[model samples]
Target chain A: MDFLSVLQFAFVQRAFLGGCVIAVLCAVLGLFLVLRKMSLIGDGLSHVSFGAVALGLLANMSPLYVALPLVVLASFVILKLTEKGRLYGDAAIGIVSALGIAGGVILASVSRGFNVDLFSYLFGNILSIGNEELALAVALSAVVLVVVAVFYNDLLAVTFDEEYARVSGIKTTRVNMLLMALTAVTVVLAIRVVGIMLISALLILPAATALQLARGFKGALLISALTAVTAVVAGICVSIALDLPAGGAIVAVNLVFFLAALGFKKAAV
Target chain B: MSAVISAEQLSARYNSVDVLQEISFEASAGDYIGVAGPNGAGKTTLIKALLGLVDISGGSVKLFGESLQRFGQWHKVGYLPQRASFSLLFPASVKEIVGLGLLTQKRTPKRLSSGDAALIDAALELLGIGSLRKKLIGELSGGQQQRVLLARALVARPEVLFLDEPAAALDPQIRESFFDTIRALNRDARVTVLLVTHDIGEIGQHATKLLYVDKRVVFYGKFTDFCVSTEMTDFFGTHSQHLICHQHR
Candidate 1:
């Protein structure tokens, strides 16, 4: 099928829509994560969601429903462990990430072998996005974007200089909790599009790419969101056209943009 | 003169080590209180404790006549943390960084009003960086960055300002002018300035009061009084007079 004809399929439309929504959400949240030196947190939370998904599968429940609150809880733990003067800092993330993947593997094996449903979730399957999942993705993305927009200025202050932000009475703790929660929600929502292994790529690459090109925080966020959405669209189209893996293709698109941004930055300088 | 900040028997600890012990002092409105001490003298800890960044082990602090435990009016207080802790790698413009001060005053996510914009503009002009408002923060010089941070702190028109070694990274020329701007803020703006610095001698003349700290209040009194205090002589011995005559760096 041609590009337009391929996109006419319901699954293709769902994949494109879900992927773009998640791209925007991840890019916005990821910028703050990168700025706060917590970029790997997306990786950590994705692994935790993997474990939650395993638990859901074992219990015969909806994996997304089970992973949502579990991921949010994991966010709180990560935030708590990395608070000021916490010796473990990144180590805590490492432990949780390793444990999560291990737990997911153990549970998956104990459940009498990895099923196709679990495998599809492990790898990306753009063809599997149902209408209900599409609606949920759109709704959740709206929530993340609205919360971020409402607190953009405050979040920026906290991200750059948290100590100074605290003194400014920005309620650094509450703002941080909110950021972590939003990150958790985004990670959960992103799983259906990029799956476990490639989720962090979506969260980090676009923001990193945009930072290379923008001089202001607002501009960087705007560019990152655009970059992410474009990557998702192009990646999906390329995936459909070439019969390639959607997650890897999307990440490949993101990498290309980052390199292009680097060239742009160098030429401008 | 009402005390804008008053601490009685203040104590603090970090990583299970007592950094401050039974320290007490008061900063009245419009007063320039210069805090001086050796490295690890709890100078930063003292400021942090007062700023509620540190956990107070004992004693009490009152700001603007309210107990520190109930001191929620952060809009009236501004703090500039140690310069070394600041990172300019993030992409925020001078205007946006300074505008963060106004966002602190907001309890909700409302739009920035014209009045807030005017205040940010005034702060930039006051710091003589209105031209650089659109410049990226990371691209500025150390002095310019410090001024931008000061503008961030001052944009809200805080009645009391706490600065923790704000000039520690600036060159001597810039440091002198930094204090000059601070003096103007205190004198013209009628704001209380509590600045922690390594330059005891330079601040002696500009500051109305000097607080010599060594884990506790070694001395807290008028600058002239501290100059002539037997406590000053006793703490540094014969070098006390020489300490007062330190060469400007």
Candidate 2:
């Protein structure tokens, strides 16, 4: 189908809206994730989401609904473990991530109804998104956006230096917990467009690219959101034209934009 | 003279390693206390303990005669960490960074009072970086970045400021000027300053109290007493003589 014809389809429209919502949420939370050097935690959580979805299918429930709470729970556990005494942060992430992926693969193998449908969800099937899912993504993204806006200063201070944040009476621990919750929500929302495998790329690439072009938090957020939107729209178009997978196309577009930004920065210097 | 900070037998451990062992000291308001030690002598850990950045393994730390935990006087203390490795390459202007000092107050989003702006401007002026307010923090030299950090710490009008190797990366000329500015802040604003450094001779001249830490309190007394003490001679070894030579050179 032609681009206009694809746009005319309700499913295509829903998918595009879903991608846009995820893009916005990822772009916002990605700023902090990149700043705090926890971008890999996003990847880790997405893998955990995949496992949650598979477990949901086995239990005869809607995967997204089950996956949402499961991912949040897993993120909380990871954060708790890291915070408890002597557990190293990166080590906790790695251990949890490995187990999550393994559980997902095992669950998928034993499930009766698993097929290409499951495969599509693993890597994303934006064109297969429904109206309800789109609405859910939009609502979650709005809530996350509001939460981030309300706590921007605290998050900024915490991201820059936790010690300074604490000394300023910002409650660094509580802020960190809130940030992790936001990250979990953002990861779940992003699963529809980028899938579990390529989700962190969407989270990291746009923000990193924006950092190259912009010189402040507000500027970076604006440029990053714009970058994400551009990538989604362009990726959707290119995927439809070439009959390629939407998720891969979107990530490829994001990668290209990041490279372009890097080149531009180098040239400016 | 009221002590702004007082530590008694403060000990700290990190992952089973005793980073700081039984260190004790006190600093009154307007006192410039310089903490000197060799590498791995627990200098940074001692500062972190004072700032409550690390958990104390033993003893107590008091601020204004109350335990630090009970007082929870975060606003009264300002810290500039040793490293300035912000993820976003100086994405903030000097003004914004200094404005962060006001984060202790529960203000509404994007709302800056006229008083807040004036305070930021005053801090910038005090650090002599007023003209560089609009410049990005990453664009400045190491010395300038250190000044911006100091301004950020001072913008809140903190009673006690803890600096961890503030002049570590600055050029010799910039380091001298940085110390001069620090001295002026202590003198003019009556701000309590706790500085960690290896530059003993210069700090000896500038600081009122000297704390020589080597995983323990080797010596803690007046700077003059420390200068004449055999303990200072034994601990600093050639390092103290090198500092003195550099001052003359």
Candidate 3:
């Protein structure tokens, strides 16, 4: 199909708009993640989100609704476990992530007839987005954006120095929990656009790339959003043309941009 | 004057190791107290404990007459952590770094108001880096970065300021200037200061009171008393030698 024809389809329009919104939210949150050295948590949580989706499907419920609360609960568990020193930081993430993906694989195996649907979720099918999903994605992203804006200063202070933030009365614990909760929600919403396996790359790479060029917290947010937007648009166009998976293509584009940014930084130095 | 900070028999552990044991001290308002110890003597741990950043295994801490558990009163405290080098290319200006100090205060959603801007400018100017306000923090020299951090700590107009080795990496001239700046802040602003340092001689010269620690309190008294104490000589001899050996290797 021609590019214009693809744009004319309601499903395609929904996917495009949904991808844009998810891209912006993920990229902005990713800046804080990379700064806090929690990039791996993004990957781990995305896997958990996949398991939540599978569980929702198996229970015969709307996967999005079920996945939403499930992933948030799991993220809270991860945060709590780490804070309580029940597990070493990275090990906690790894253990939870492994269990999540394994559970998803087992669940999918039992539901044999939904293999194609599962595959689409694993690798993403942008053309499969519906109006309801689009609206939900837009609303969630807007909410995340508003929260970040309102608490931008607190977030920045906590990200840079937790001790200082606490001393300044910023309630670092509350802010951290809220950030993780938002991350889980964003991951669940992003599954339709970027899929489970590659969602973290979309969330992390654009922010990492933008950090190389942006100045402060505000600049980083703007640059990361723009970079994510560019990656999504280009990846969508290329994937559609080549009949390839959109999620993997988008991640590849992000990786390319990250490498280019590093090269640019090195050459400048 | 009321004590701004008081810790009695404070102890902390890391995993299975005892990092600090039976450490006790008190800082009254307008007191310039210097904490002197060899490496691993729990100087940093003490500061962290005071800030309620680390958990205490024993004893109690009070800040501004409130228990450390009641950290809602943290607004009265400020801290300057040791120089943690950032990537030289990290894209944040000095103004932004100092601006982060003001993040604890109530602020509007948009740009900072003129009054907030004035406060930031005053902090930068006080630290003698007004011209470097717009420059990237990563681009500054070691002394300049320390100054920026000090400025960040002072921006809050705190009642108590905790500085961790503020002159650890600076040159002699810069170190003197840094101490002068701190002394001025204590004198002019009447801000109570608790400084962590390894420079025993400098501490003796500048601090009103000296606290000597080596995983415990060896001594806590006036600087003159510390200078005359035999315990100071013994602790610095073995402890200081160990630190020098570690630094050389």
Candidate 4:
């Protein structure tokens, strides 16, 4: 089957649109997360979303409806713990991540084991993304990308030297909170594309690849976004051709790009 | 001359332990005040507190006659932190780093305009770093990096500049040039300067006044007063005091 004929399917179109939006969101936010040393946050939030999904499934409701707020709350808990300066960021993320998985496991056991829907969310089923999910991804991407654009300088300032940013009157605290909130929403949106098992890879790999050869901050951001979108599109095509899992295929493609970037850096040096 | 910075009975804490206690002082326009103290003397804390970077456990701070809590004119202030505290490897160009100084003057939805770019270029040129604008920050040498940071602090042309050991990491040649630039700004542009340094003797050459601190005000007066005062001689041994005040003499 040719690539053009593959686009004939509505499910394929929806998957491409939804996956690309989520990929871009993850890529942009992932660079900041990686720079700020909060790369584990996406994994932590996805675990929380897992617990939320279990709760929603048990209650016979849509998983996303429950997962969004619950994951956001978890991300804030991590943020507050880090903000208090008592606990390290990784430790806080670890604590919340452990609790989330534990809750999800307990809920799953209580509900008599994992069903097909739970399994799909565990590894993702991008080809099964509905029109509603696609619309949500596009709308959320628009809002998130715009916010990132508007606050790009502030974010750079806050991430680089928070003390300098504060004295410069950039309102460091507000920008930090805004970043956390945006990451929460993006993590939730990304779950549909990469699922709970590999969400962090989606959030981190593209940025890591970009940083391997990027000349400056803006270049890194642009390269990361492009890498992520390309990975998603190529992953979808490969998944369709080989009848493989889209999430795994996407992560595999990202790994390839990261290796290529590493090779490129070495050759340049 | 009107005071550009004033603090009354200001106190600050770190980990619930007092670092600055009832620190009171005033800096008039164009006043070059050198803040000197031993390690752990809270000189850095005082600078942070004045800028509202650290929480004030007590007292009040005023900048440009506006209370710290109500002061909204941030473009009027600049701060250059200790070089050791900065992250050098962050992915930013020198131009982008200096451009941040202009963000303080922008409102929400802040966007850099062509005018802002011009200002950044001017600041780079002022610091002799115009050629390094496109260079990555981490790729620059220590001296070049310091110049970039200084340009950032000076880019907005702030009325008051706070520098905490700004040249502690530079070579003697670079350090002299850096101090010369700061002194020129204070004398020529009339920008108020509060410089925190460990080298009291070195600072005495440029600063008009001295504010010695060790968790509290040890002394606050003109270089001439500090040089001739019997009390300062008593607090610091005559030999030590003379060593610090020799440049003033």
TM-score of chain A of each: 0.97, 0.96, 0.95, 0.97
Name the top lDDT candidate.
4
DockQ for candidate 1, please give it.
0.66
Q: Higher DockQ: candidate 2 or 4?
A: 4
Q: Which of candidates 2 and 4 is the stronger one according to lDDT? A: 4
Evaluated at residue A81, the lDDT of candidate 4 is 94
Each model's iRMS: 1.7, 2.4, 3.2, 1.6
Task: Give the Å error, residue B189, model 1.
Answer: 2.5
CA lDDT for candidate 3:
0.81
> Which ranges of candidate 1 are over 4 A from the true structure?
B84-86, B242-249
- Overall lDDT per candidate, in order of appearance: 0.86, 0.84, 0.81, 0.89
Query: Which number leads on TM-score?
Result: 4
Q: List native contact recovery per candidate, as a fraction of 1.
A: 0.64, 0.59, 0.47, 0.55
Where's the lowest-lDDT run of ten residues in candidate 1 chain B?
B240-249
Q: What are the chain B TM-scores of all models?
A: 0.92, 0.88, 0.88, 0.96
DockQ of 3: 0.43
Better of 1 and 2 by DockQ: 1
Off by over 4 Å in 2: A85-89, B88-90, B107-111, B227-249
Docking model 4 quality class: medium
RMSD of 1: 1.9
True contacts kept of 2: 0.59
**Colliding residue pairs in candidate 3:** none
